[model samples]
Target: MAVSRRKFISGSGLVAASVAAFPHIARPADAAATRSGQKPSKIIHLVADGMSLATLSMADQLAHLSRKRGLAWLNLHRRAGAHHGLMDMRSLSSLVTDSSAASSSWGSGSRIVNGTVNILPDGRELTTLYELFGQAGWKRGLVTTTEITHATPAGFATKGLKREAAESIATQYLDRGVEVLLGGGRKFFDKTKRKDKRDVYTEYRVKDYALLNESADLAAAPLDKRWLGTFAASHLPFTVDHTHDTKLAKSIPTLAAMTQRALEKLARHERFILQVEGGRVDHGCHMNDAAAAFFDQIAFDEALEVCLEFQRQHADTLLVITTDHSTGNPGLNGTGLRYGLSPLLFSNLLEVKASFSEILKKLSPPEERDKKPEPVTDPAKIAAIIKEAIGYEITPRRAKLLVPFIKKEGEPIYNLMNTLTCQLGQLMANYTGVGWTSGAHTSDYVPISAIGPGAERFAGFIQNTDVFRHYTNLAGIDFRNPESPLVGAVSPDSGILSPHWMA
Candidate 1:
């Protein structure tokens, strides 16, 4: 009963399959038109923050090369009957959006300026998606690889004047009744780390939340109690660094684990809405750290597989996968060697034992007061560090550049380490035919893929705000009210609907 790999691949319809299986897009049971009165009981929306189209393409290609299968999201369209489309992601103030504005578009169904969460330009606070869902008797939760209060997750439930006010965002989560909150940002919750001296963990514990920190606690927490877990002080360690560290591997939970726990807790309710974000994909692209971005992308896709399994059991659940905006514009460009590219070169990323930040810390010892530290004059030492950390041999020219730079007293090592990391990323990409534009968000449409009930509504070119409309519609929330101040007029030219729009 041994099944050959070819037969398995062919049976799955993975290879040689176009994304849209248009003929099978509709299922009679999932058709909204045929439904009597039952609504989708759950909506599991996932965001691969800052994942541009090129990022998706590169990740999909890498998965195919390494495992003979593409990303779960892409394969959903190819193998499963899912709807795929392109979505325009823009903030009110600019074509390019920060996470706050991008997420707020879907959260508030309103385009707010970049940096502000669920707050309109005229100082009005629009209702958030989670709040609306919560009011409609739906349990709500958020899971991410970034700080729980980071812009994307915070947008779903809280209104903040600025994204930097993560401390305030943390407090608002308790106020908004988000039953399951999982991610990092222990600094915002721990008494010693909080600027306000508030012991937010104690506050949540007092509020009957089963507060958990370590991975074991998260795994063992009772399913009946509300759960709040923070596995790291800041954003969870980058997947690339955390996976290789034995201690962190034991303590830290992967994005998929947090997502699974979130689903377990929130799914107990008759109706629920959950957002699971691969928030580090944005951070990796911001640093132009291709290895970090690519690996995190893989982790994010793995989280989607978890959702897919959940959806298989709960057919009433509507699942949506998308990115807030494209970042880094990563591309597969030729590497100077005529027609020579190797996907195997990317394997070196696994050899990167430490992040540049970790390496820089090792290079600079604690400073002695009033004493100037000696410059690192050894090129071999520099080369050795590179070899150990990233498995890349430093060229003579690169070594010459590193040996002269010393950590002077009062000097910051961020610039030196950041530059070196970017250089390493560029070299890795060049060897593997990968390149990136400047480390900034781009004005490009990211792909959107969906399955389960009401998923067909997401097909074709759509505005970012349309997502909010569709989600609310599917969830049976009466978002359109003419009397409500949040509703406004839509601009005919730009096609941007005012937050006050009523259907």
Candidate 2:
């Protein structure tokens, strides 16, 4: 259990700094045996979609800025408690990997073409690991702050059409009989909410099978998984917004709650695979809101705590924490902000855009309503709203910069806000001397930290596809048709194999 990589951490920097710091990670020893010789009975994969090295760095800086001690990923990395290693996250595209390809990399073990999931770059479809796990008799679950049917979770759970089909994904979870399905996105399940307006949840709850809308939900039996629930929609409310709305928060549990119930339900099977994603981290990062991103990661960190605690009780579990890709690549310049401001400490950029746009809409004269002062990008007006709702102020210069980017092409207000948020995190950092770049997904190998069975196999800079091989091999699943070159793994150790360590 002793860490061997501490001495290598000489100075502090981003990915480069830690790369040298932990040179030799302790390989987790092989897990216990079932009827066959395999790694372990449980594997929990925690994917923070769109988490770039910058996201990791921002999470740490945000935690430190907001409070004294920060999150465990930073705290544990700081002290080398968990298994820390880099994962080379390249897609078959090899340029930039979207969530579909990046998550598909993990889902299929082969890097698929950019826009598809579980299918190779050549359009060959592979059965997703979720189905594979189900067939293998292992309970599986997918949890997200976004719709449970979103790209990251759905990539593993089902396949069809494009990632755009949220309704179909919702049906997949129910049809697949996944033990736990938790997240936001009420619209897709509510048929009536659509122009089609089919209330899928009410239908499912009412057991009115005649009204089943999607292909997947037709034959669905009523689910009574004690520890699980599902909501069908695209995105969930932020923690800040959750406080104001009871229906949103009360209707669904937090990611931690889902994970806990998942462990409660799925762990009983003796072998299970669950993927918990803090999907909104990418959203917050996209907007450049450190506060929202930070807290969400904390919410994710809370899930991590639930997992780590659960791991302590169930040693056979291999808990792997990593990201599919990086977004916005936000960061601080190591100066300014006597205190570090976390990425989560952000105002809802969407709210500002909505409010500001509303003010603009009201401003147009009735006679000339069609014409809209190029829309007041006034920072003062923005500051008033943000200060009240989010407790932050924006200067006129920054507010003015927000207009052109947000209003053009009739873009969704959230997109414009997300764009400005990136600026906001950096701008806030400047008061104490912080700077950052605009949004761009980085092609960087995310940090893949593991802490149980088959974990040693994850060490070092391995290709994205390699993860598929190792996870399937350990979980008693199969790889896709296209065989990838084998990347070597670190030998297993006691920590991962310990009977009580369920990650």
Candidate 3:
């Protein structure tokens, strides 16, 4: 099926501009020949975690404006033989699924509860796709912008009751013999940072894994051995910050670099399955940082380009690109009379230099002796900070509205939306023409784009749990995870509990 580009761009002028700017995106005559009727020997699953449809649209717009090209993922929609569809990402416990459950549904062929990885609510452990592939002698790999042990990657290989168990999850990756593990969470492997003081790094090294801690190491490292790399104590720096800081750019590899390296290492094996995640895109959405989210989405697209290039050379590979679920429902709103100013306002996103998290640190920098930094309540200072970081000038009155929340003086109205980050996101929307519905996951049908062998299996509407079956079938494996009787049980009236902030 030909994926539609109608929703991606409206005017013919913009389409022509996109094609002219990125002429290499045009499909080659041999592209159709790369699609195979036989089972795929390799699969590359790419996830832009927490990406809503609007997020993808805005990211494409941003890329056209800044990079002079449309995103590779969106470009795939224009390919004649590619498959495009929507996926229902609801979990067993709730309509709005978290990353763990969303990925678990795909990983285990079962709708597991939120906050859990590959374990049913009733405590039965589901066999994950990674374990099955490993049993069949296929090399496995995971790459992400978040901690390698984060929910999305962990959902594929580990069985745990809590997604927060990073240390345990890291250990599981080593035990499962996943050939390539890249991304952040240095604390999970460093003895000094772990709760139990166990050096998981040493364990990997002892097992002949090539441990990499810096971006430079990745280039020189041999691809013959198992690889484990961690570049941050927690999640890697947001793309916005990483782009601005030279030191960070040198230390941390981009998502595309990690994906390329992972594929090179895995390609050495006869068969392999790799999962690449732009995990921090979800973090950016949760924090309501438009530039952060969009740039990370672009970073995810760069990785998509790497996968596409690999598939062009390797016909037996299956490539499935999708998100776990939607978060924040961020969109560029129509601005001014008849929306004449919408494009101009949306273009202001180019001026954004830092994420809300980085801006907050500057606004409330810690004092000596670890004392909490006093909020910068001065409207002039606040306006100055906003102007410097976001390149938008706000009136003193508008700046003052953020004082109460920043100072923690009292709970503002609409407690959830009133967060300092959310308030900042709202304030910036006037200039950027971006707005967020809520800083939480939504029960929306996310888009799926697939190509190469078995790509047709993902076309049309499908449940999230069905992905596991498709993947297993493509790999010539037949196994069904035990289902919990409580599947589809309505969650208790917890009244929209705040997301586990760090997850």
Candidate 4:
């Protein structure tokens, strides 16, 4: 079933969407954090990096986006159907937090300024939730489709001078020893890829741990607490290409694959905490690739499916699924290129890009080769497909630009076509009565859902900073330690974190 989006320009709503991700007010720390009425054997943090309300709601309504299966999160909640809740996801700084600040909000239980991690604007370095979990004798792991060093994952594992400081980010994970570190960003570990001539992977001194990057190597060195894997030269390719290059995606793992591996590894301990990040959902939204974005959301839905499955067996675990922030509101609007509603007319990104090239080739004259010429379109087929998809006929004149714009193959006549598609949801907004601004995060209160022990505490409207204390207070994770230096006091310009906090 297709998603229904009214796309209305509602007045100020969704606090997280408007206030930026900083704390306007500071509340007393909840004493219940450490010794709450309930405790879980495990903690699973499922994050969708740029997930907006519209994005998630639309995905949920699509019904078929998750490969014809129901959304992974929804199905799990329905089956176990225990803790339903909401989270106010603004960071301490900007309403539009880059993944780092947003991730740090939950990671540190305190919102630091935008562009900065948990360190305060003054000069203090706060310990992350995982650090607390580790100190409490619980195991920890991180799984992301993007590079582990990327903002969201790094928010949980490392904090430093800059979000761009991937080199240092890679080093932070080396000694801390998170049980399972799966994702892309192979460049950070390889000397050849880094601007600095240092290969951190080779220098990593953990003895006896298997640093495997290929499927074949997994048997040689199974994923263990002592292991760290980097599977791509860059962020792993879109999920569509995972099978094509297994080596890069092998130990790196999918959202589902890593979620399972983390659960399997961490489950050995009496208690464990895991953060599974669907990082590219935001990237796809940024790139304005609907097919890629939608599919990536599907992949995350699969990961949630796996997380929900684990929750079924381990009844005590607290499962919280939500986005750190939303990108442009991708609300679906009614279709406009309705050319007779043909199924073949609306292909995915690759297909659309390819089809446009093929359609143009069929129209171009052999003699027209090296010269700049007017864009041409084969409206006959284009019209038929449009009709199939939306039940309307597009003019051959309109097809001249629209078809090539949509297909975007090789040397095409349009520039910034992706931007156009991202706007499609917004343009249809007026007609559908839904409203959206261009590529930007809105200050809206994000939805937060929780299940299992203390999950009820997450419901009702709350502040973004309250979220930090919610779990920290639940787990009794402390940030204040005389041994630990004051946080956020250090200036960003100093190019260093306080001595006590290693970035």
- The candidate scoring highest on TM-score is 3
Work out the TM-score per prediction: 0.82, 0.72, 0.91, 0.70
Q: Distance (Å) between predicted and true CA of 346, model 1? A: 3.7
Residues 1-503, model 3: lDDT tens digits: 01112211222232233223322224453443654566788899999999999999999998888676879898898886789999999888778889998888999999877877898765688899999999988999999999998999999999855887888999999989988999999999999989999988999999999989989998777877889999889899988788777788789888888887787777777789999999989989988899899988988887788778777667677899999998889989888899999999988877777788888887777577757667788998999998888889899999998888787664656665757888888888888899998787889999998888889888999999999999998888989999865455554573323354534
Candidate 1 regions exceeding 4 Å error are: 1-38, 65-68, 336-338, 363-379, 400-420, 480-503
Looking at model 4, report the run of 10 residues with the lowest lDDT sum. Answer: 3-12
Instruction: Give the poorly placed runs of model 2, Cα more than 4 Å off.
Output: 1-38, 64-67, 77-82, 194-199, 202-228, 231-233, 243-252, 336-379, 394-398, 409-429, 432-434, 483-503
- The Cα RMSD of model 4 versus the native structure comes to 11.6
lDDT of 4 by residue, 251-344 (tens): 4456665566566666666677888888877765664444445556767777776665566556567888778777766655444466332222
By TM-score, is 2 or 4 better?
2
* lDDT, each prediction: 0.73, 0.58, 0.83, 0.58
RMSD of 3: 6.0
Per-residue C-alpha lDDT of model 1 across residues 1-503, encoded as one tens digit per residue: 01222221221321112112112223343332323334578899999998987788777776564446678887777645578899988777777778888888888777777667788766778788888888888899899888898989998898846777899999999988799999989899988989999988888988889988989998898988888888888889877677667688679888877777677777667788999999988877766677678767877887887777677657677889999998778887654467454445654444555565555554544468888465454767766766776667777566655443433332224442334444445545644456766566788988999887777788899888888888899887878411123323334554332221000
Q: After superposing candidate 4, which stretches have Cα over 4 Å from the reference?
A: 1-36, 61-66, 76-81, 205-208, 216-225, 241-252, 335-436, 480-503
Pairs with steric clashes in candidate 1: 486-499, 486-500, 487-500, 487-501, 488-500, 488-501
